[model samples]
Target: MFRTPLAAALLFATPAAAQQLTPAEITRVDAIVADALASTQVPSASIAIVRDGRIVYARAYGDQGPGMKATSADAKYQIASISKQFTAAALLLLEDEGKLSLDDKVSKWVPDITGADRITVRQLLSHTAGIQDYWPQDYDFAAMEKPVTPQQILDRWAKKPLDFEPGTAWQYSNTGYVVAGMIIEKASGMKLLDYLQKKILKPLGMQAMDQDYAVGPGFPQGTHRFALGPVRPAKPAAHGWLWAAGELAMSAGDLAKWDIARIDRKILSPEDWAAQETEVKLADGSGTRYGLGVSLGQHDGTPMVEHGGEAVGFLSENVVLPEKRFAVVALVNADFGGAPGEITQGITEIFYPPMTTQPAQTIDQARDALARKLFDQLRSGTLDRALLTEDANYYFTPQASADYRDSLAPLGEPVRFAALGKPRLRGGFVNRNYEIVYQGKRLVAITYAEPGAAGKFEQFLVQPR
Candidate 1:
């Protein structure tokens, strides 16, 4: 039978002003990760938790390879997108040294690309440059097998038309970072990797960080598991064009050390750090929750600065609770099965328990019953117009509902429909996850609502599991 993981109040003592990880906290952290490994079938992972600028707990779980056991002392994995923070930091360091300015136009360094005159270094860092993403949402997986140089990548995509006007909208673009890396080489008169090694990694004593995949020593292999069984070897991917964008390998503890440096101001100055943390706003003053390479959000009512990374076979998450002086980093050698946010949030809740008013248990029956009714109506090509919000109504029209039903038709009718986990509040919106079983296959349904008598549904989605 399925069970809610955090069903009861598994609380820890309030974090002391001095902040130390208790033995009890360490056991809980181990159990949380062990459970995740078992459920996801990921062979191994590395976890590190830092508090008050020091690593209090760091460990490796499972076997690293065919016969070798994974150990925290030496294991390293590709950190994927988390490398963006380093790229952003390098640019800021250059700015501090008066080698380059954030406001400098893209044309100042690499002028062959599109919109070079309008895009700035700061815009590239924040992903508002409007340059077409080199690896977009519809990125091709076959392209991974081919090696690419940074300039080759730019030549392929940079001269294309802008997706939108610079600073008008935000779009995540690996191309922006690639171009930024080129600018770094031009301004510093050194290779990007060499500059990083001399100016940042060596100074911070990050001895394990490396970018060359071919000459680099072997570490851990990434795996993929499609079902509940043994995982298969995923192709060893090279960073290729993702050099300064998402190409770095290091241990979780080392990553934690580098992150804690940010909080302690060991590298960038106070003003530069502030600029890194502050969100960039659009032309209309609407906020974009991204600052430089970091994503800004709130967790447990506390401010969180974080970034997640994903390459072909590795997934990484590094999060910092600046106000709490806490940070957690997790690196998993699995394609996408690892739940980094859940892992990080599990650690966060140990220090700060849920304080939001959970929707009363009495209302669950009503909510699920309504969901079933809506589900049936949607499958039968009709919709309860009163049940949907204006936005939902506009998006989930009869035609759209029919298309959705057709999408699920291949699965046959659902054999079971049950709530997957406890309903919780996120950013003031109450959301729930449910499992729908059909002919031995499982699919997921997510629904969100507004929480009172005016608690109408704002969004709903269904997808194959």
Candidate 2:
């Protein structure tokens, strides 16, 4: 998602040498994972770290089940939505063989799907198809407890009116991917999992990965309701419910193998890789910061391509820093809140320390004043377009403006509004983060300004703390 070509090239360049973690560093990582398991009371977690195309750390902590064998590095955990990347890879491979194109209309394969004629395979891959998401809740509810075919899912969800016109906005819809998976089956003349196994998994030697339905009765089961008290077994969604969206399971070690392959560009061509990594743009020409199945962002100014997954009882996180040839994978057997993601961030800090922030007093007085004014304008729903860039204006659509006003007005004026840290340069724009507190609640605002004496706000985004 880096705006400039030079910045993108620098971030995605190949690594030079392998740097193994020191013994002390390994110990620190061990402590971090152990503490998370203890504090969160999650049953078990498997972790793997890859540096310079090699696995430097692979370990598991805690028990697999009550009084059962302890979890091992090879133990499988349902990876949920992380499976979308594999589904995406399957389609890309088909495209490479001239069997299909990402631009093909969905109606070509799934002709009955509502709005299928207008939606492209590319939009479905990037979550811009405007289809309503069938599975939005975190847990497997009553309807998911029973088996249902992919066609049933599409009939129930995709046949309805679209959430918006195709590609005008970005909204995550598992239903769209389910449609894409059907297309893969039609184009490749093979089952979805069979195609993935033959084309990608087996070639990469990822033997540990398998579809959840194919696994035998001996496979480890995850638990839910553990967050509240004692562990309770989670009821996984029926076999076909997850389909192409989130049905695969694998160990952290196996996931790391896939990460290494991605770093080396093993499976897809350079052009395909670029297409997979590039952020999809909205109709208004603003970036969605999502490419295919992965979420795109930066951590401490380092580019990151990553994804997280949640099932009835499993939670997983996978992150890769292509520039540094570093990646981290964390998988937990319990659905306790965000333990895998938190553990990934904690371990990442061991390699990349956070940037130091300047004191609030050191912030430019004019910028601070302008930020406060913009905060008020956002709450009042009366933004001054002259102070904003064209992109920023596009971002503040009527619905978005009403959303900001409705959400922020209730909090009233902020008790505190100040710069979060030193402003940084990105894409030829000065980017700054600010902390805004209303009553006792906190919110963060990120602004990108065009450089000038009277800099216009190129972007202003607000999210709750």
Candidate 3:
């Protein structure tokens, strides 16, 4: 929960402009995904780019898994949290039909819920209900393995006190969506998945959006490389528990189709569509970066509506530049190290390159390499004088090195290192920051370096974030 902020910051960097992609720029989108697959060693991925309510680019690359050949353009991959957008849409549609109202008290439908009388349907949609997240990453796995029904989920979670008073703060809560899913069933008299198929999926001709693995042709296999390692084959989302929270699987192409139709307002009225895109306000009327199920923000000066998802063995991202009528949807089969947003940003840069270019690629490479080397030495309780200037080396002397060792000893071993953002030339030196997570500690390694033959560490600091 805490770690995602860094990645989100990197993905939403402001660009100078936004425009339509030319034919050559569209080709570069494919190249970006291809390079990502080759460099990261990701098994397979499906990518689709849409423009002006049309599918401009949709292709799959690499193998589906160990034995399968390259994935097909239509091969389904779990869309993860992107499913939330549709769930939110369905609820809004119900409101349009006079079946329910966003201002209606949730207790009206689920009376026994602890704070249902105080929370509104709009609060749940916007994650301001203060409901605790149901499947926190650290939750016990044994409980998740056992199937659960919506009523069982409500009985288990709805009676607890909210994390805070409704509309007071914003915290992403999968449980809120799970509760929303139940409300859809109670108000509409249809299963959440079946209602979506009849109301949204079939209407859009999105055949690839399967509710669960047991039905349809099933999802392409996915593998997790960290923690749990290789998981069992991917399947449809279970009926209960994760149902409305995150349980839809579809191809990148199909996901793109949904986004295209959304821009065209094909399923819902214009007012309802606008509500889905509007950011929710807290008790003080401060805007949350999130709106309903989708996030609302600007990328490179261009307003954007987007969402990303990560499940057992899949990672997906969907970005829509509504003003430009451009969207990019990427679905990957591997977990742990995939960068769907980075791939999406690379595509965005092609269509809307940054206004001012920065340092040469070589400078960034040098900074990253030197930063890694310094941190490696620091973790080992030593400092490499050769990598620093005489004045810089004096700052991290032997005594200081010993102190660093003593202070950081309890943090345990370093487990992961990742760039926080691109290296940039600032004050005549290249500045960069990297996230280094220890077994129990997380820190940002801030570094400054001078490039060329005399390039060496000008400044270095590593401490708790």
Candidate 4:
């Protein structure tokens, strides 16, 4: 299931009219990847950047193994959980074809699953099905060495006691996705990979992406290193063990093609894309900051849609700036550290510098003070309605207030509370993020205020760090 990185120099394949990165910028990128490789002892990495729906940069760094040739641009790595997005897309595609409904109960397709009648396909895609995760460890365990069918996995994990009531909370569960994959096969009457190829991959021209189990031989190998020890070939999970959850592998460039398609909204309808990007709300209306398959958040004030992947001997990060029509894909052949994510951060900063914020004006300072006061009020299960907009008032329902109080009160008083980064301007509101540190835990508070001399809070959200 692994392949050695090929020998190749830095590769650049961009349209003539595409935005060009300066030589210095390219040097910075190279330094970033090289530093990550040296620091983490990761064998190699493949990176690709897309701007305006065209690949602006593609390069590889390090070697195939200890003293082997340099890594090539086209070398594929197991993308791991990044494959979840593909699974989600397959289900969406079925819905588009009127073959299945995301709202359909799991019992409709696979009734043998525990609580199938109570869980919906949409909940599975969003990781809110209350299904216990079958594989939660970062490193492979002995159980992973034994091959098991998806149905067997479900029988072992999905049939267990519910982690919580469905839709009450958000927990990352690979078990939910496995069940989803099974549903796809039942609804489409095709293998999971075949359905993906016919409906998603082939249409997007992502020829380089495929399930790791199906890749057969002649591919490069991925390595694992312990401490500062020598690199050794990593042992992958048995075939079918990672089905529908972390089974896919691909070159960074091919992954970038998928990102471009997302940027251009080429595959799914606009409504479907919106559903995929919207943060899921729990029963109490608290946000999970996770969409169907991707995590939703802001990167230095710009909206970002992204996901990270980890499999034995490989790590990957994929990021998309939908508003800016930009994307970055980083794949590494070593899984011990976060080289791919670090490389992604460095590369993203080169193109989108962090926003600068002036010192808070008088009104802004008042809002900051108010944010602190509101945090305390939330801990006490109380709020000052006169200081909030009508919508905000409605948002703080009795149940929501209690939920906030129960969750925040247990954390006790914060050791530190301060503004984070700079204020963001959007939709005529001044939004700011605040960092709160408890005895041993940290949380972030997102605040939105109406712009005026006497501004009122429009939205205030608290999320765990």
Best-performing candidate as measured by TM-score:
1
- lDDT per residue as tens, model 1, 393-436: 76474545766666554555788888866775432346766677
Q: How much lDDT does each candidate structure score?
A: 0.72, 0.76, 0.70, 0.76
Across 1-465, the per-residue lDDT of candidate 4 in tens digits comes to 223222222232122223367789878887787767655566678888888778888876656543233345666778989999989988988998899999999999988878899999999999888887775544465567788899899988888877777899877888899999999999999999888888778888886455455232434466664322345677777777777987688778889988988888888888888889999898999988899889998888888999999787788999999999999998877765467888898899888987864455322566678889988988887778887876667657675577678767777788998888766543335667787887766666767777664688877767543
Q: Give the TM-score comparing model 3 with the true structure, all chains together.
A: 0.71
Candidate 2 lowest-lDDT run of ten: 1-10
Residue range 1-465, candidate 3, lDDT tens digits: 011222322332222113345768756765687666544445667788888777777766655653333346777777777899889999999999999998999999877777999999999889888776655441123355567876787777666777788998887777888889989999999988889999998888887544346233334566543221122344323445467887688878788878888778778888988999988889898888889899998877788999988776677999998788888888877553445876887887777776754443332555566687787677667677888754457557565566566655556667877777666443234567777787655666666666563588766666443
lDDT of 3 at 98: 96
lDDT of 4: 0.76
Candidate 4, superposed: residue stretches over 4 Å from native: 1-19, 66-70, 214-217, 356-465
For model 2, residues 1-465, the per-residue Cα lDDT tens digits are 011212322222222223367879977887777666655556677888988779888877665554234345777788888998888888888999999899999988999988989999999989888897776544454567688888999999999888778898777778988998899999999988889889887888876454455233545567654112245566666778877888688878889989998888888887777778889998899998899888898878888899999877788999998888889999887765457987898898899877954335457678878877887898887988899876667657676677678767777777898888777543335677788877756666777777664798876767543
Better of 1 and 3 by TM-score: 1
Q: Where does candidate 1 stray beyond 4 Å?
A: 1-20, 67-70, 137-140, 211-217, 227-230, 357-465
